[model samples]
Target: MFQGRLVQGYDFVDGDTDPSEVGAPYVNPAYGHGTHVSGIIALVAPEARIMPIRVLDENGEGDFWRIAEAIVWAANHGADVVNISFGYPQQTQLLRDLLDACSDGTTTTGKTFPEIGINRLFFSIAAGNSGDSTFIYPAADADDSNGSLAIGASTRFDRLAQFSTFHNRVKLVAPGENIVSAIPGDRYAFWSGTSMAAPIVSAVAALVKARYPNLNPVEIAERVEQTSVRISYGNPQIRINRVDALCAVTLIPPATCNP
Candidate 1:
C-alpha cells in the first residue's frame, strides 16, 4: 500500500499525496494509514490486541454509516477502546444515537455494555487537521459522557500543531508531527495529522483499561486528561492537555501533571 501511483520510495519525505486527484490505483493519500495508527497502539501497549478495522478506503474517505457500523462491530467483539482518526465536518443523528447508546449501556447498537465486561467502550478521536476552531463531527459529538475524547495534535516543540483542529470539543493534544510508524509491506514512514495523535492517546487509554478494567470508560478518559501536562498555545488563557501515560496508570500523579 505504501507504493502509490507516481510516488516512489518509503520514508518521512516520500509519503503523502492526493489519491483522488491523481486517480491513483491501490495507492492513495491514506494508503497504509491503518497500519500507522495500529503500530502506535502496539508501540505504547505492546501486549494489547490490535483490531484493524476497514471502514474507509485508501484515501481516508468513508461514509458515516460505515464508520458507525464499524464501531458497533468493534465494541461487540470485545474491543475495550476504539480509535477513530477520521471525522466529518457535519454532525449526524445516526452517529450521535449510536455513541449515546453505547455510553448508556443499551443493546440498541447490536451490543450491550455488560456483554463486553465494561460499562462503555472508549473512543479516542482526532479533532481534524483543519487548523481552526471549526466544529468537527463525531469528535464534536464528544460533549456526552460516552467515553469519547476529542484530541488535537501538538508538535515536538510543545506547541499546538498549526494544522490541528481545535475547539470546545478538543480536550487534549499529543505529539503528531513527523511521527514514524509502520505502513504496508513491512515498511515505515513519517506522517503528520491529528490522525497520528489520536492513536498515541488511545494506546495510553488501552494501558489504563488493562490496569483498571472495572473503571468506567468516562472515568478512564478523565484520568488521562486530569493527569495530562497542560500546554498553552497561541492564546495564553486557552490551555490544552497533553497525555502523560505514566501519570494516568500510576497511583500518584507525576510532577509533569497539572494540579
Candidate 2:
C-alpha cells in the first residue's frame, strides 16, 4: 500500500537489468517483509543509506542469477554493505562465482564503468531460516573463504534460534526473533528466523564502514569477529555482539595512535 510514499522496494529481475516491468505478489498478504528487514538495518545505522534489492518474488522464490546481479549492481552503485535476508534450498556454482568475482575488485559485467573506488563490497546473507542443522544455499555457498559474510540467528536470551541453520560457515550471530522494524505503508512489524538476524549484521557492517572508511570489507569482518563477545551453544560456540559496530566507526584513531 505504501510503496513509494513511506517506503521503497526493488524489482528482482529474472533475466538482465531493465528499467521497467516489476510485479510479484507476496506469499503473505503483508508485503512488508523486505521492508521490515531493510528498516532494521537502517535503524542500527541511522546515518547509513539503505539500498532495497528485491531478489525474492512475492511468492518468496529468487533465482541465483537475480541475486548475483543484485550484488554486482550494489557494488557498482556504491553500496558499502549488501544485506541478503533470504536463502534458497538449492546450490548454484554460478552464484558462488559471481560473489567471488565481485569481491575480487573487478566489474563482472565486463563493460567498463567509471571507478567507484569503494574499498570493498561485503555480502551479508542470512544463514538460513530452516531449523535443521544442515547448511543452506548461498550461505552454504561460501564453499571457499570468499569475502562474503554468512550470519546466524540468536534470540534476545542470547541463544541460537532452533530454526536457524548453523555451521562454521556462519561468521556471527545476532538478534532475530520478534525483531521490530519498518515495513510497507510505513508500518512496523516483528519478524522471526535467520532472515531477521542477517540485517542486524548488515547494519553493524554499515556502522563499521561509516566509522573506519579505510577498512575494506574483509578488514571490517575481521575487526567484527576479533572484537566480538563470545558465547556458548552446547557443542558449537556463537558470537553475540555484532562487534560494537558503532564503536568501530567512533573509535579508530586511538587504536591507530597506540599501534
Q: List the residue pairs that clash in candidate 2.
A: 25-58, 131-163, 211-249
TM-score of each: 0.83, 0.79
**Candidate 1: global Cα-lDDT?**
0.76
lDDT of 2 at 243: 37
List model 2 lDDT by residue over 1-259, tens digit each.
Answer: 2233222335664443432224332544325677777678777777777666667655566677777666666777777777777776777766766655555554345533233344357777888877765787788765224457778887777777777788778767778889998765556877887888888877787788776787776676666655555555766443344434544555544344222
**Tens digit of per-residue lDDT, candidate 1, span 1-259:** 2222111111212123222222242658767777788788777777777766666665668787677766766667677788888888889877876676666565345643343333367888899999999888888887426777899999998889999999988988999999999876677889899999999999998899899888777787788888899876778878787888888988356455676
* Lowest-sum lDDT 10-residue window in model 2: 1-10
Off by over 4 Å in 1: 1-26, 106-119, 254-256
- lDDT, residue 22, model 2: 41
In the order shown, what is each candidate's alpha-carbon RMSD?
7.6, 5.3
What is candidate 2's local distance difference test score? 0.66
